[model samples]
Target: MKSSPLALGLLALGLLAPSVRAGLTAGMQEGKVELKSISQLAFGPEGVLFIADPKAAAILAVATGDTAPASGSATLRAEAINEKIAALVGTKSDDVIIEDLAVNPISRRAYLAVSRGRGPDAVPLLVRVDVQGQPELVALDRVRFARAELPDAPADVAPAAGRKGGSPRTESITDLAYADGRVLVAGLSNEEFSSTLRAIPFPFSRVERGTVVENYHGAHGRFETRAPVRTFVPYRIGGEQHLLAAYTCTPLVQFALSELKPGARITGKTIAEFGNRNRPLDIIVYQKDGRDYLLMANSSRGVIKVAAEQITPAAKSITAKVSDTDGLKFEKIDWAGVAQLDRLDARHALVVRTGAGRALNLETMALP
Candidate 1:
């Protein structure tokens, strides 16, 4: 969902100045580039790979060279998604851990990030799974990449290190989405001690900016929290475009697109709070039977489906925590263990979830 820049100078730039996009051929910069950790990812035009390496305190957009047109034919079939993935990563069925899933809009292929071992010794690998459920390593050789840096990112500090740390950054990129020629990223910030949403133009064609969004959690001034947004979608409500973002303790908030200027401190209008303890993982807006709905995937809880008819500019923010329905009707999918989800097409969604026992599986199913 982002990139890491060289120094703090570029991050301080405004809209008037233009700079050359930092480009890298994947394997060529191996010695100089280390993706210590990959928390979130998204794809852009011309096979551009947006990788969020929170541990390294930077985001890198890698040119993967996977420009083939997507089959766009029909849904893919993965008979035993987990077993196949385990074999490809050279890990036993029990040793495999599927972290996240994303479908490329252009290639229509599903990508999975997996860990081969446990704890700090685990090895992470990116696997490309096709329509037939076949898995292959996404080659990083000879690929082009760009970096965007977040200044003053909290360093990954070990408790025993006595405050001295590596890189002054350890923030995580919670979610990523690409739309309208820009990449939208949501995550927590260690430097500012607040949640942030960033809109970066494609191909590193311009400067990058980060926005600090604050919102009230409970009653107006009784209790408030600047929690990080877990996931979000760029959508239009009441004929006006906005960023519909979800935060921890699950508050659905909206910010008008026009108000997201750099250096502007914005307050989100909290529209709905799903529950007290639930955390949202991913959210996608879709249409069905000539009606619109907001499908949100959650953690521990279940998938929630809210009718779009309930979302409107007239809807007021929930200032107080409630026990029941909050002006909107919602339904939970019957299936459990759906850890990750994304829109595959108009009527289908690609999900990566825990399968039998401890195994993981990726499958496409009709929208609820």
Candidate 2:
């Protein structure tokens, strides 16, 4: 549960008039959108869907106009969602790849970034799940949309230096989120210090060079700059906005939102090392009993719950290496086989988890 942005707050309170909200797309064009690939998905005010296209090295903001307010208490459960999506698209469950899931806060409907096939030619599809747990394709054939291209994205070719085998451009934009009117993108860049984070102001402006980030990876036992942030959530610490970012070979690093400037290099404060041989998949912030908490899903490590109250401005940074996980205590959750997760509402979470016969099921559960 990343902190809801101001736009969301206003929309929830019915303070953002339809005319004022339409201003968010004032400069945008309306037409068919051709996406090279869809890597990440996020939502902004007035039902604007932010789609990250790594292959094209661009971000497309589309006016989904799905602003129908939802009953916050409603829940959704679509079992074997992958198979269902495959059936809907005339494919097999194994061929349907669910790239990411995002819950449109206003609609309380789930949107999934899906790859219809598994090769380079795999078609990208944006599928929306209704409250009745049904899957439907979001029509992007003709829509009001705007695009922002990264000025310094990595080349769309080959294995990058010091890497085994994978397209550098594919990881050019690993994760992005809309917060405080800006879309924060994290991934590799073409610069010498490649791990970058860009805070591109919304409404489709020119994308500037992102702030290069480096952190002390305890598992690797040294400082690193190439490993991109796997997943992160926007949070507030000491009355200022910050990103609680997690990286591969897990390191929980903190970066002030204000410090992210064009062409600047910043060393994030490493607060915790969850361990090596693990990749953080997704993270969300939620509150229970009036205290905030962070729930993160991992590959090797099970879902872990961190008391957000522990993350303070005075918390010490883990500058030195340790044998395993260290700094900022966290408790493992009982959730199993969770591949992706997002907050469906304040009280429920939408998860794509493994079920019988290796099938992926989409279900909503009470926030743990």
lDDT string, candidate 2, 1-368, tens digits: 12258877887788875534557877688899999888789888778899998888788999898988896488788888999999999998899999999998888889999988999898989999977788999999889998988765444454466576744333457788988777888876544445667788776655443344443333334644555677889999999999998876568888788887765666678888787777899999999889999999888777888999999999978867577877889998888888898998888888999998968899888888
- Cα lDDT tens digits, model 1, 26-78, are 22233233466666777666566677776666677776667777655568656
Q: What local lDDT score does residue 207 receive in model 2, on the 0 to 100 scale?
A: 42
TM-score winner = 2
lDDT of each: 0.69, 0.81
Off by over 4 Å in 2: 1-22, 154-171, 189-193, 206-225, 321-323
Q: Which stretches of candidate 1 lie over 4 Å from their true place?
A: 1-34, 71-73, 93-95, 154-169, 189-193, 205-222
Lowest lDDT 10-residue stretch of candidate 1:
22-31
The deviation in Å at residue 24 for candidate 1 is: 15
Error of 2 at 341 (Å): 0.8
